[model samples]
Target: MTGVSFHEFRITDSQRLDFHYEIDSETEKKTGEIHFQSNIPIPFDPDSVALALSTMCGSAYRRVRMDLRVSPRARKVVESFLRCELSAPARGGVTPERRRRGNVLSFSGGFDSLAALRLMPDDTNLVSMDFGGRFSTEKPFFDKFRPTVISTNIVGTDFQRNSWSFMGIGAILTAPIHAAKYMTFGSILEAGVDNLRRLPLTSRGQTFPPFAGAGYRNAPYVAGITEIGTAMILVTYCPEVVNDSLASLALPGEEKLYRKYVLASIAAERAGLTVDLKEPPPPATRRPFGRNFTADFLSLYIRRFGGAQVRDAFLTDVPAEIDALSERLALTFYERINTTIMQKFPVELAGGLYERAAVAGLVPYTEDDWREYMIVRDALAPYHPTVAR
Candidate 1:
């Protein structure tokens, strides 16, 4: 076997058998594939799922990189699978219409957010917050863009002590209290749920209500987006991810990548939008660099390129004090981040929503923004091994 291998396929109609063998010239490995036909197609409960899977086996699906070749007979049988399925059909327009009209971009004055905000209609509200990160530049940036901007500031928890967790080291969970100021628009916030769960509690022992945990919230985006001026909607999807595959990702970024896909997917799905989850789509506006808003890209990135890439991107672009804190907090984080990232690296989070929301949803999930940020993130992960994602 060699590093590269190609498979040859053969099928026998009389026996209803298929055979495949692969020869790798570089890796010097031998592999094979085989299949046998039954009297009929095995019926499935979800016919559309079968179609989706079958369509996914080809290059048509953009969610994952998959290569599955089937015989014409199998292809035909698969085509009929939907007819045999009994599962509930996908409800078209299942997502409720936003009762009102309003557009809210997670405006950070960063390249991506600013660009997104700049492109939105002037009537759209302008909101900004810094999950304790350096996003205050948002207002000034908007000032120059001059798009009828009305902004607010938000503060998040300090999680530098627990940077190695699945949370975004500095991302705000609830977009801070500022979001509540604008939650009355009868609109949806375009951010992730991780941010929703991390609203800071006041001395009164009160914070944003935990709707998902308690079932009090129907729509995390619109109905429960109680905060004013901002909405954090997870608008990404990666078809490859199913269930909680993100938990096992070696780097937090990879897990974030899986979740980004889910978020982006859910966003587009609910909003009747089409997005390419396999790759980073240009921000709705033109920008040189997109803001790293979600944790979706980090996990896959760290797993492949290591946490060093993520570290450099954060420290160089976002003023993350990774180098200053690496030695100081390495061992401290190692004890808490028992899974995923390497614990030896110090990952003092400036504290934000990503950490607060993630500590609870540890079951496992993933995102899909890995390809875009891999370059910078890969280069930086080696220094901060723990907060690699």
Candidate 2:
């Protein structure tokens, strides 16, 4: 891989942010531009610009030397990842600036996002990225408010979506970091259940959350911990922006009945929004993951292998963590998660962190673990499987 040179970036008159760059080779010379379009002009933030470019570049290049400004942390993270993961080197020269304002909600006008929108202050900057190129002005999700909607047809590229995990990360990175105080992603507690329930039936072990990055609350974007590694990198490098998820904040319990009924009751009573099955589509996506599971494989792997730094990087202080409902719900979730894995996967293939790590010599465990594992694996299954679609 050759070094990627980023030429001057400019917001075109057509509201497109363009990065002009070239790759020189013995066989031929290659030139290209990475474009992000917004109906509104995107204010330039060097750190944001660098972060977006690096994210789009992925781990393919040997060296990424860009002229744009970057935060020290952003520069450090990119250099660290390239060196450690890709064995590549990265260098940049740039200064930081306070170029953004107010919380920018990745509003999709769905149950989770709408619920989130209701919770935010009226003045919060609501932004919807048309990553899928499905942006329609007539869509119901946009009818409620006039927001700064940024739409793009970039998802069809290998650099963007070839790897399933990178999709969400790409969508998040497209955000106008220059104008955001905090960046909020729309994820729900059901997302956690979906991931845990859909734990891969293979030897891959616990995986990162399939839909959202390891369904953690207010998790800072650390390179290896979260599922969508880029988001963690963005938030980590740009301290000016906070990574938040209202769904993670509001729906801590993993109970389906409670989340669907009880939590709805709570949100409706508290937020004054309608909570029911027959509702309009959310501004983001109406139908989220129906059958896929999100896992915290990286975090669990670190807990076993990377020691305290990695563990602490992914951990957070969950406010009140759980309640009576959540406590019972959690117990039920644990018992059911094990049983579900067993039923859907071979018993030999169903174990999570403990069993998988023990077999691989990554962690130490004994026969005592089997009894506890069986309790969840063989116990009478509790929660009934719901129709995710």
Please tell me which predicted candidate would have the highest TM-score against the true structure. 2
Off by over 4 Å in 1: 1-106, 118-135, 149-297, 302-389
The candidate that achieves the highest lDDT relative to the unseen native structure: 2
Residue 294 of model 2 has an lDDT of 29
lDDT of 1 by residue, 290-326 (tens): 2442332232322222244433333233324433233
lDDT of 1 at 289: 19
Instruction: Please report, as a residue range, the 10-residue window in candidate 2 with the lowest summed lDDT.
Output: 216-225
Model 2 lDDT per residue over 1-389, tens place: 56557776777774677677676545766676666776566564454455555555666566666776555556665555445232223335544344544455566543345434443445666666555443332234443456665555546543463233343332334344424444444453324434334345452223223211212112111101112222222222221211122232222232221222222332233334333322211222111222222212222222333333333332333112211222222121221122232232223222332342222122221244334333322221232143121
The CA-based lDDT of model 1 is what?
0.27
C-alpha lDDT score of every prediction, in listed order? 0.27, 0.38
Off by over 4 Å in 2: 1-10, 20-33, 58-61, 65-73, 81-101, 132-140, 162-180, 190-291, 294-389
